[model samples]
Target: MTDIASFRLLQPLSRRALLGSAAAAGALIVLHPFAARAQANQAHLRIMETTDIHVNVMPYDYYADKPNDTMGLARTASIIGAIRAEAGNSMLIDNGDLLQGNPMGDYMAYEKGMKEGDLHPVMKAMNLLGYDAGTLGNHEFNYGLDFMFNVMQGANYPVVCANLTRGQLASDPKNDDLFFKPFIIIEKTIRDGTGAESPVKVGFIGFVPPPIMVWDAKNLEGKAMTRDIVEAARAWIPAMKEAGADIVIALSHSGIDAAAHTDRMENASLHLAGVDGIDAIFTGHQHLVFPGPKTWDGMAGVDPVRGTLMGKPAVMGGFWGSHMGLIDLLLEKDGKSWKIADFTTEARPIYHRNEDRKIVADVASDTRVEDSVKAEHEATLAYVRTPVGKTSAPLYSYFALVADDPSVQIVSNAQTWYIREMLRETEYRDYPILSAAAPFKAGGRGGADYYTDVAAGAIAIKNVADLYLYPNTVQAVLVTGAEVKDWLEMSAGMFNQVEPGASDAALLNADFPSYNYDVIDGVTYRIDLSQPAMFDKEGQRVSDGEGRIIDLMFDGKPIDPEQRFVVATNNYRAGGGGKFPGIAGDKVIFAAPDTNRDVIVRYIIDQGTINPSADGNWSFAPLKDTSVVFSSGPKGRQYVGDIKGVAIEPAGDGADGFALYRVKL
Candidate 1:
């Protein structure tokens, strides 16, 4: 992580801070250093972006099966009318990941098949909002090319993607036959000052991360390939300028990173912004907002306060239709070419927290947008509510970080059981089988309310989805005992180092996303918070001598470093999603066709009922007189007595509507 001296690693953007920012969410604050030079030929163009929508057409959480104020295109669409009225000319575009996320997307792909003429709910919603252009995200390929193309057929606007190709890649980007149109120059007429209408060719290019080939290797192994994000941008950008395009805007579905550009780097938006011909950029795929004070505040090459990346106007709309990214540009028509005179960027949120920390919808759902997908929305509700199986215990992820959680436990159990059955007759049957699972809803960016909580008995499809967020298939990897230990060491980065006698030190690393904190079942380990973490938040080994993982054992004995084990995990980890050590594509021995969620459902149904209890396989090592505080949802207070293997008590309230709990070691 970049050095952020003023920012605290303990507490993320608090509810009060979000509330403070909400005040400006309604205002169009110009962050440009100087005012635009007034001229008769000057035109103000507003570019609106909705990225990482993930098929959230309605303001509803399909997993929780409830209406949410923080998400949905309907809520975002409500603001577009007022925003368009505030600008001289406007264009709305989506960055990508619109095809799949919640049960609505799953229902369409699985139960209600998408044919040629059938309009997908998200596309229908965007079409109603009159989106000008869109691009494909990595998740768009989750259901395979055929389903993706069928859904894309419903999009009224042109969808372009520059990087993805049918098969082999050529030496140069231009020589490659792309799967979609590389770029499009939209010929639009903008009314300039003094009532003069002039022609403007605005070029929009799109790029997805190169790792889509690996992430979706099962579906895209021989069918598709990709070029680096910056490579594609470098080749296509100059061509766009050569093709009579005046202002080029990049709809990059990649996040910003200041690290030196490497081959096939996932987060390459910062480097893409440095490309010569690109004028403005809209970025996503990290599910984070740009110009936010918390995350990208002091990162190199990023000016969150000014909403600029590599000195160009840039914005990232938060995921799931939480916010709409806006870039207001002052364009000066100098004879034939148009130049950007001044600009402002903002990510207007759909909701905010009140003074009492209660979420309030800042914008109501646009009824027109909601009515467009009303049928599918109701069908999705019914689909997710379908009974899957039963659970003997209540499953929740509130204390997943500090304990072996049932939410993750059930997934790990299901995966291990499925993998064991699959490998029973295979050569790998001799190897001890373990399973790795993580808490997908442990209240990171989604805030205090974002956690999985299921009551005992009568589990539904939505509850299973709550347990497993991504649509990743199951994979079994052959790893040695040493690699497994190192993997747990990497996961230990989720906790902060504490002094021997420290009091009330923050325990959880707020920057470390909870999804990456893998808990491996069929093994026991202890995390020594007194020692420096062997790996950094980015999964890089920063400490060689000091280690956090201690007393790691498998099958009730000290594991041999050379002993091989079959570890069942999701395709994302097997394909190197979190950069875990010694686990990648080469190590994957078996790739199952079924998704992890499906496996969980099958496991639940086969058993009829499951205990769904955490086995207390891992815990923090003794730290003398040390106490650490961590935050979870306020509802976690009721389950504090159920937490095993750790001593914890209420520490009072926390920021962002979270309740604090002190873990005494």
Candidate 2:
């Protein structure tokens, strides 16, 4: 979280006031020791959290196939050690997303294979660090239930997730308590002001996003069921409190939102805070840090930033080993009870800031962790390099978002092709198909050199992962014509609303994450930038809530609300990432048991040559006497010549150092 003034002390009260009111000054100084003692003896309960780890045990990014300094649990090892040394009492916990992300994870899953007693490398590293507990992230199910269970067996600590349960039974007879436990209680000694150790019981309850079973339906089918996060918390918290636990902490794998109540879209950290007896909440999945102390709406005395629930303390650590969350709570002895007197919360980054605004990694790799995964790393290098298939023509997504480009068309065609065969015996086999794919290699965050450059030749497995980095399996959600329109309106949230005839309007939304925008190519439509977005970044509807999609037509006709169509997308969106109407996971007609990256690879293999050209199936809304400007790097110069019906000219360099282009449409 950003630094706030509340944590820092102000210059000793105005000298004039001190001098004019000597009596009040003396009284303030007399009371200062109590406040100072409270701050000094504050039972600092340091909570170190890692989220969305995606199995990067080493300091590397396997998708980019490079040693990246920006992400890795190994790099953050020093910070974790230092933070633990500074705190009075510390607990290390991982908020899920640990199972799959890199080639290393894939290598372990497919090539090495998890044996019954084999220890997973990632789990071994986490064990060495002494993790107290962990929850399941959506990616944990990528390798299916059996694999997940086998991997968890390697963890030295309890794998806790209250929301997930086995099918048809309270326990799995084969390996009871192997995959997950509802909660865990740890007894620790806390030091009083006189340095006397007092016994304290800390309770941790873990919860994963309930939507995971829906998102990873192919893997979770008939194996497990997931309950909503808040509902699960409500059921579990009371029992946890009754179990004689003084402090209760939530390892929430769900996200925190500005919303006050629990909804299908909002994970409801606010609602979780309102629940009685919840002491502190450790949140994840959203990958954001709470900016400051925020009281739960309609709840008394709960401050999320101060790491307090119902006057207790809470924190949401930033993701990818970037930051470790710290929450310190001070308790006062009152007769036979220890009640919290004060608290503080901080999200500390692992990297240090340089004068040039660059983050410097300070930790050296833990040799034990590195040695454990050395064989796996070498195997992944070879596995990713293995040629999967040949692409007869260049497969580029330069125009994927603006036009019906072959890159997206290839993926769309592949999804439609895969679903048709998979659902031959299903009831929805006759449904019309539409595919939603986004420009994963889009310009932003990914520097100028980050675009896809797969030449017309043998494509390797690494290239496939590059094209689709996220571990999102293919899901086809059935929707009516009107819902389809709303879905498009939601996708339009990617662009900034440009005023009519405004030449310098920004093309993309700075705050709206680019990865979440899915460009549906099967239907013809136009984005009207003149209208505001239908929804904001938090999924809240735009103030006006009027449709932003203009002239939306399906099959050369105006959309028919009664007509139905199946739009193929990744599991994330179908599970609720977009919050688009009528497109939840329940609407899924078919979920391919393979990742979208795998499908793209198979598609490229089946089709020898991809021309990488747009079919002109979609275009912008009419721009009469209007000119718009956008920025792209020198690499994008090659494809700007392909935009139809637009007069394009080189404008100037953008503030970000990319070449700016002015287009008259």
Candidate 3:
């Protein structure tokens, strides 16, 4: 077994002290600059990262019910095996969120019942590939503590997380909650650039967002909670170096969006990189790839071209195994200690989406991983494929952004039904209930074929899973009609600011996550493209000017500003996941412990046959003589005849084969 290094309490770290220690850490990395040239006892080692696997053990899409080349750790194993074969020394590590995401993970927890002796498919696959060390992602807590512990108990490798420990108050400055180890040091032999073998002590410390306590409060309340990631790093990193670790790699489950160098930031990787002792950082939680063109646009302190974070190598392996983050390091022996000489980063993909939208696969499904977890994989397939209910019309999200989509409609219907039933016994039953749902399978970065397509007929569990990808629980928040307007205005951020009349004007704001573009049922409104967004991505209002929302009405009348209404949404949104207005606080009136997927399934089963069609509750405010262009999957061509509202026609091919459409108002 590899050696485990317990984080001994050196000193308690206050918020101010953590910041001061972070300053000191930054100084250390700068003073110990990367050495130049090939010196005595030098070598090259490749660090392989498979982050946000999300329990996709097989090279298959459980939601799509087909073989997927882009996702799954099994496909990633082919990359790891090849990279390791070409390197003198290498370490394969995961960046967390391996426990849950899709139906297979759901099946393992709900149906298969992770018994005492049962091994999780993710654990089986990782063991077969020989993972060095790993950490937990936020999704790991979705199924609650017992289930998470059951999954981790089957692991053959050590998984560390500085935050999220059992039996401790998350609010305490210093607490003894050592349910899991904070860090681990691996002893490995690597040849220096001079081709001389030397021993290296590689230290690994993990961090998850402190917001997990709020995100998964049902599962984690009074059981496990997260501390501030930056604070945890400050307390543990210096201690790791003191424990004789040659190099420290931060397995941060946070993203790199934190421009402010402060504690408790959700995306704290940027701040963590500024710390002195961290040699490199591997991040996830945003499901975006570092050193990629998508994130290179004006991000501070990130050298996307070179894949460096604060002059140190960093990577965020594309989520769901779409890409494997690789960091090749050149190490040299300085006296007896190993120091980084040079390094490079690239998020290598299992398949490439060419400019022409062709999927060029790098390798086939890994037989080793497949065979290792063949039993569990097969069981999950059968569970999701089992027929649950029926649909009268085809359900797809091809033009979800441009039109009211049936895919999101079904989700809203489910939430609305669940909320109405739950509120019947309460005094709030008189209030109007509005359901908010977003298209999770809309074709975007997942490629042109990523959109959900369920033919009119028997709907399976897999089809329902496609409609709602996350395991978020149902929640109802009470907001005034004015707050509701602000909420809709925030969702309008998905569209780009448009001129009154221009040829081929861009429509979609590529920065705003499509998942946050919630279409609220039980209301009628129009998005005005001519106006700039009032709210930014962080839900902060940039202007009080006339917002894009026009003709906001409920029950065929203009909503009164002071009127009260109940809005149904998932726990993530209600807990301030997108920073939407009037959410995540005392305003939340109802919290249902059932996963939204279960609610969807129950709705489907309750309704013998779903009327799969959007209610046409919202549309874009007509911009006379103006045409806006937006992109959707090429599969959208099959459904343009069914879309309502403004006339939409195919313009041409878009990036990654996303069918470009011109909406002539």
Tens-digit per-residue lDDT, 233-260, candidate 1:
8999999999999999999988887768
Clash pairs of candidate 2?
307-313, 307-314, 308-312, 308-313, 308-314, 309-312
Full-model lDDT for every candidate: 0.84, 0.67, 0.79
Q: Candidate 1 versus the native: TM-score?
A: 0.70
lDDT for predicted candidate 1 compared with the true structure: 0.84
Model number with the top lDDT: 1
Q: Which wins on lDDT, candidate 1 or candidate 2?
A: 1
Query: What TM-score would every model get versus the actual structure?
Result: 0.70, 0.68, 0.68
Which lDDT value does model 1 have at 432? Answer: 94
lDDT score of residue 409 within candidate 1:
96
C-alpha displacement of 322 in model 3, angstroms? Answer: 1.5
Q: What is the clash count for each candidate, in the order shown?
A: 0, 6, 9
The sequence of per-residue lDDT tens digits that candidate 2 reaches over residues 296-403 is: 334444454455554546676766676667666666666544556666777765555689887565444545567767887788888778765676556665544445
